[model samples]
Target chain A: MANLSIRSVSKSYGAVSVLDDVSVEVEEGSFVVLLGPSGCGKSTLLHAIAGLNPIDSGTIVIGDRNVTNLPARERDVAMVFQSYALYPTMSVAENIAFPLKMRGLDRKTSDEKVVAVAKLLQIEPLLGRKPRELSGGQRQRVAIGRALVRDPRLFLFDEPLSNLDAALRTELRAEIKRLHQSIRRTMVYVTHDQTEALTLADKIVVLKAGRIEQIGTPLSLYDDPDNAFVAGFIGTPRMNFLRATVADGGKTLHAGEASVDISHLATRLEAGRNVMLGIRPEHLDEKQGVTLSLAVDVTERLGSTSYVHGMLPSGETVVAERREDQPRFGETITLRFLPARTRIFDAQGMRIR
Target chain B: MATAASDPTRHFFQPIIVCLTVASVALTLFVIWISLHDLSLMRAGREKFVGLDNYLRFFGDPRAMAALWRTVLFTTLATVVEIALGLAVVLFLDRDFAMKRLVRTLLLVPIIMTPVVVGLTWRFLFDPATGMANYLLSLAGLSQVDWLGSPQLALYSVLIADIWQWTPFVILLVMAALESAPTDPLNAARVDGAREWQVAWYVLLPMLRRALAIVALIRAIDSIKAFDLFYIMTRGGPALSTETLNYYGYIAAFTNFDISYALAIAIILTIFTNVALLTMYSVLFPKSGER
Candidate 1:
């Protein structure tokens, strides 16, 4: 296992830049996730790190060796593609042993390593089956086994679970986490799924439009976002943004038809200034800091807790979490949230302290 | 739930199926009937039932046996050489290059040409005295060689003409297969620490196996029945070196006017071709249970 450092990496295709001056540092044995929506250059960054893509300007150092100009095979990195990219004509055992065979390992040792990886992946019975005979989930397991058999310096995954069904994705995601815990190898994974990033990553790097938006621990990013985009992208049910203006000499915030006292943050708010109030759904409680009324739109129940999506009197859509009583559609409900739990962004979407 | 007569789709297809069955089955029966008799243009009015005599004579005729051997040799060599050369060319052209579409278009010229034209063109090129082959040989300080006149080189000269015309056909098919094949495995092999050649050998070639086998089968079938190039270029050659079974059947029917023997020869060739191709097809596409 080795640490990887990407310095001033930039890649462009003719006139379009895919990765623009991106840099990331992943500590040895840490699981770092590159998380973002599609077209965010998250996969491009992972490919760059794997030496599959040549960056226009960057020096990538892994274990004190600069691999910026090296080919993928020379970089000692194994990548699990989103498509599972198994050698179609090869059986599971041969697919797993391909890297070792290419490295000129002895036949007996390669066979043993293949068996060990198959056992680790719980695919021992499937070792003789060709890829076409395997199901989608089984194929991915073999793909992971292929990457694991080599024990490369770094493991890279490009949305490895995106192709499976929801249940299989969760199962394999947990298996991948368990595998990482057992091996403790340096791994860099790329995915657009925030939940996967939050569950499996030691550090989640949230990217947007070919640039790094925020890089921090999963909880840190969820609890303290650097910008409105990061705040909205990191959370489930999405963070609600309400346009408001400072009033009462910065002691209160006045949205369209409702006003809430912001005495706790009066120092940070200037009178007559416009800002966006960011609130998490879970942060909106039935009994806390300030009261707000919502004209109910819908309620989505998940057995224990329900998400109450409604329009605030301020004319902005908000989702509030409720535990006890469920509210029906078109019912006005009162919810409260701590002013300290809210995040304020300027009109430009930049966080204001 | 629909009976055959009541089904509209089946009604539309029935005439086509009937026509094809009658065309193939009736023709084959007529050929078999004629093969059983001693029918010849030399004695048109005295035709009589020969009852396997023509078939028995084929086994003893040294010329017929030699022609059958020649046919086998030509078909096997043409198929193997064309597939190998075509695959090599396709691999070279797989990458990006200037005028790639133009080059591909140029490769189609030979495939689209009539075999007769290809035969005549190669015949002119192989002329012993004034041909381009000898002129190039003289430029390289080599002696003039008889490409088609010599009995030893005649069959191979025809084989060359067949190869030149059909290798492009193989290229077109294999290239299409290569383009449609998933590139992910190739990339995976590269990342798996395989060298460029290793990736092509282990990953790319295996992926192209089904396509190559199919092309080989088609080329073999075509080579076995190859007639135009032999007719136009060699015409059974100076000493019968290029006398393939098909050409021998033509000679028996037209030159010798032995229609019954010629029909027998054709029937034998058909049976041989079917058996050989069936064996090839089975080898190329083995059953899953066998695997």
Candidate 2:
């Protein structure tokens, strides 16, 4: 295993830039996840690291070697594609042994390695079957086996579990995490699924529009986001943003008719300036710091917790988590949140620190 | 078990089925009946029932056996050469180049030309004295060679004409297959540490196996029945060197006017072609359970 360092990487296709001044650091034996929505260049950055796609400007160093100009095979990297592209005509055993065969490995050793990989993946029964005969989950296991058998310095996964069903995706997601922990190989995974990123990654690199938004641990990004985008993108039910204006000599914030006291943050607040108040759904409780009345519109009871989605008097939507009580629709409910839990952002969506 | 009375779609298909059965089965039976009779165009009214006499005569006829052997040789050579050359050309043209569209359009010229036209053109080019082949030989300071005049070279000259006209047809179909194939496996192969040549040989070619087999099947059937070129270029040749079974059948019917023998020969060629093609088809496309 080797640590990978991407320094000031950038790529473009004709007039459109796909990866713009992006850089990431992956520690040895750590799982680094590139998380972003579709077309956000997370996959492009992963491909650039794999040397599958050349970057316009960057120096990618794996361990101590600069692999910027090296081809994919020469860089000693193995990639699992989103489509699970197993060679269709080859049996599962042959597919797993292909890289070894290409490197001129002898048949006896190659067969032994293929058997070992098949056993590790729990696909021993599927070794003689062609790719078309297997299910999607089985095919993905074969693909992973192919990559794993090579034991390359780095493993790149380009949304490998996205094509499976929801239950299979979860199963394989856990299997991948367990595999990484046992093998201790440096892996870079790319996906748009926040839950996958949160559960699997040692560090998450959040990207937006071809640029890195925040690079931090999963909890670090969840608990303290760098901007409104990160704060909203990282959590379920999304973080509610209320447009508010500073009033009363920077001591209070007002949105429509509802107002909250911000005397603790008055030093950073400027009077008569527009700001956004960001609050997580779980932060608002029945018994807490500051009370705010909401007109309940709907309540979703998910066994242990219920999410109360309501409209504020200020004409903003807010979702609050309730552990026991379920509020009636069209009724006004009072929910409170600690003032410290509320994140303040400027009009441009950047955090105010 | 839906009956025709209950299935409305069968009403539309019944007439087509009847027509096909009548056209194919009736004509074939008529040919078989004629093959069993001793009929000659010179004495058409006095035809006699000969049973299997014509079929038994074929076993002892050295000329007919040699013609049959020639047909087998020509079909195997043309089909194998065309497929190999076509696949190579398609792989070479798989890349991008400036004028690729123009080159592809130019390649279609030979495929669209009539077989008669291709035959006549190649005949002119193979002419011994004033032909382009001999002229080029002279330019290279090589001795003039008889392309279609010698007993040994006449069949091969016709084979070259057949390859020229049909290889593009193979190229066109294989190119279409190549374009439609998913590129993910090829890229996966590259990342699996395969070199460029290995990528094509191990991944790309195997993916294209079905298309190549289909094209080979078509070329084989056409080569077995190849007649227009041999008729136009050589007419059974300087020493009957280019007399394929199909061409010999034509000579028997039209030249010697032995109508029943020619029908018998045609029936034998048909049976031979069907057995050969069926074996080839089964080998290429095995049962679904087998690899």
Candidate lDDT (C-alpha), each: 0.91, 0.91
Q: Report DockQ per prediction, comma-separated.
A: 0.59, 0.63
- Please, what are the lDDT tens digits per residue for candidate 1 over residues B229-279? 899998998799999999999999999999999999999999999999999
- DockQ-derived CAPRI band for the predicted complex in model 1: medium
lDDT of 2 by residue, B160-195 (tens): 999999999999999999999988788788889988
lDDT of 2 by residue, A1-353 (tens): 44899999999998999989988888999999999999999988888887778899989998889999988778888999999989988999999999999999999999999999999999999999999999999999999999999899999999999999999999999999999999999999999999999999999999999999999999999988989999999999899898989888887877666567787763567789999988899988847567788999999999999999999877788999988799989999888887678888898898876
lDDT per residue for candidate 1 within A1-353, as digits (tens), equals 34899888999888988888888999999999999999999988888887778899979998889999988889898989999999888888899999999999999999999998898889999999899899999999999999999899999999999999999999999999999999999999999999999999999999988899999999999988989999999988899898989998888787666576677653567799999988899988747677788999999999989999999876778998888889999899888887788888889898876
lDDT of 2 at A226: 87
Clashing pairs in 1: none
- Binned by DockQ into CAPRI classes (incorrect, acceptable, medium, high), candidate 2 is medium
Which sections of candidate 2 miss by over 4 Å? A248-251, A261-267, B1-8, B96-103, B127-143, B289-291
Backbone clashes, each candidate: 0, 0
Model 1: chain B TM-score vs. truth? 0.95
Best candidate (score: DockQ): 2
